[model samples]
Target: MTTAQKRSDVPHAALIQMTSGIDPQRNLATIEEALGEAAAQGAAMAFLPEMSVLLDRDRERSSHHISLESGEAWLRAMQDFARRHGIWLHTGSKPLLASDGRRRLNRSHVIAADGSLRAHYDKIHMFDVDLPTGEKWVESAAFLGGEQICVVDTPLGRLGLSICFDVRFPELYRRLVEEGAELLAVPAAFTVPTGEAHWHILLRARAIETGCHILATAQEGQHEDGRATYGHSIAINPWGSILMEIEGGESDEKDYRLALVPIDPVATKKARTAIPLSRSRAARNITL
Candidate 1:
């Protein structure tokens, strides 16, 4: 593990909300610009939205863009970019061909300031759903579900990684908290209906129950692939308070949006000590 350069007792983190398109080059440019800006604002780490590199739903079109993580030039460039900027980066999630050579995976990469991969977590839950708005997503059909949970140390804290659909499963967050995760990352590209109805509620519930800071960088606006996503990327504190948030919706104002939130380890400790949810769980041995 690379030693995290602690800049301050309380570090600030950047949350990037993007309108990523099908072209990987264009998306890379957008993220590069955001990373520079985040570094300029004195952020120690930047968290990007899911599918930061490519967002096309068309299997044939997106298949060509998906490559092995080791051979993916775009990912390497981003790592170099992180090293150059002297900041850590959590690449919300990227689509990559699985090592098995048959299926794809929605994977999140955590790159240290030295450009070394600290950890990578493939999204365990697939967003296979049929929305009320006549939209359907069969993520399991295209991507293989991951089996392991990833929790890693960073400049901010021990981060528990999860993707969009995984947010709905509270058991995952509980297990993450049990593993001593101080922060949880739930990068997503959620549909409008689901986002409006359940996004904030679910995020707050997770934070409150686990007593961990929640950072949900998101993909917003309409994409080149004809899909629209709910925006409003947000950061929630351990007490379920909204620390920072960006606007939601399609706009011609900018290609992306950014916000920096302070991550206070003191708050995490206080919340956990006050509630003691873990102890309560230990007091009971009931299974559902």
Candidate 2:
């Protein structure tokens, strides 16, 4: 058991970058390994990249594995892993059986250090676009978008949950910050082209605009489905500074990529005081 009862004065978030495959079990192995390492290092929480547990472009065959009914192994394993390690886990995103029962949704789950389910956010913005690289994504066809913006309270800080495509929308971040979110989680399986063009810049912009610490974990390298994902998982401070990032290429299992970020509430306060964007919102009526 790697659960640490003592809290560090300053929390360190472990941002994990993984190149996930088709097998959910294999991906969970990597996640458990990363959790052990993170707990050993005294990390306050661990944020995994999007599709960290499973990435299968094929909806039909993938459903057999990705679909989670009550009492599923993958979700149970994840919760138990977090509990045994005594660490908070921000799952990047996974396909889970929705309330409708017939469909699934891309959901980000927050498991507390005590191994209880704290909160969950469904991906609000869908990836429905045709990229310049000739790769097309119709996320809407497979999963439904979430209508609510979710912010949850935690020991480290208030957390705002969002998926890959949501990073493009500044309004979401602003709304989250307005709701007292000091930290933003962006777990993505971004395409290589879009990620190269806008990933870092967009993440920094969100952090600067919202006055929050942003952790964008991501899927890197090509997957079993032949789709290449942009993998440059990073952590940004409230002042829009890249504190740390992944250092190696895709599929390098020899070197586990984890960036340690200080969760600074003082920096968030200072940034908000300096900018005062919330006080100066163009639309005073928009709700999160």
Candidate 3:
């Protein structure tokens, strides 16, 4: 416990970039190591990349490993790990087996230092797209969309939670701001091609548009299942300035890294007042 905790109620949060594989056990081990290092470095909170629990190539086989959020052993281990470290843990995204057992839910969960569940967010937007490179994804086939937006308060600030693909839609984030979000968290397993094109722009834009600090955890490198992800975990201030980025090459598909930054509430307020994008839009009238 560092009294750095009382500094304007903002604390150091670490963003982890990982490359998860089909084996949940191995992924869990890797996460434990990474989190241990983060805790040792004096981080009060840590953000894990989306699907950091597991990534598989076979869509049907993945269902076997996906577990419901409440009763999953792996998720429990994650919670215990957080409590042991005395640090807030943001489990980016995991596959929660739906009650119907026909599909899964791409969900994110927040764990307090005491290991209690603070909030959980299911990803509303599905990544369904076809690329010219002959790659395609119909995410809706494997996972159902989430209906609600999630925001929660902690030592850091009020956080707006979202998974990958949700970042592309600005409306959801605007709604989050209206709900008093001071930070935006994006956990993603983004494809390399799309990451190269849209990763930085989409994240920075979200921070600027809402005047909130952004913590985006990511997966990088080619996985055992043959999926290649873009890995550049980043932190940005309310002013949309890049506070810190993990040391990684654009093609560092197998490299794991971390980015840590301090969040300041006053900076968010200042940026909101200076830009006022939301206020300006609210005052305008549109005719179609």
**Mind giving the per-residue lDDT tens digits that candidate 1 earns over 1-288?**
011233555798999999999999999998999899889888989999999989999899888888888788888988998999999999999999999987899999999999999999999999999989898889998899999898999999999999999999999988887788999999999998999999999999999998999999999988999988998899999999998888864455557888888898899999989998777777896664
Question: Candidate 2: where is the Cα deviation over 4 Å?
Answer: 1-8, 250-256, 282-288
Residue pairs in clash, model 3:
221-253, 221-254
What RMSD does each model have against the real structure?
4.1, 3.8, 3.7
Top-lDDT candidate index? 1
Model 2's lDDT to the true fold? Answer: 0.84
Q: What is the full ranking by lDDT, best candidate first?
A: 1, 3, 2
2 or 3, greater by lDDT: 3
Comparing 1 with 2 on lDDT, the higher-scoring candidate is 1
Q: Write the per-residue lDDT of candidate 3 for residues 114-203, one digit (tens) a residue.
A: 999899999999999998778999999888999999899977899999998999999999899989999999999899899999999999
- The list of candidate 3 runs beyond 4 A from truth reads 1-10, 249-255, 285-288
Relative to the unseen true structure, what is the Cα RMSD of model 1? 4.1
Candidate 3 positional error at 57, Å: 2.9
Instruction: State the lDDT of candidate 2 residue by residue for 45-132, as single tens digits.
Output: 9999887777888878887885554746777789999999999999898888777766678988899988999888999999999988
TM-score: model 3 vs. ground truth: 0.92
Runs in model 1 deviating more than 4 A are 1-9, 249-253
TM-score versus the correct structure, for each prediction: 0.95, 0.92, 0.92
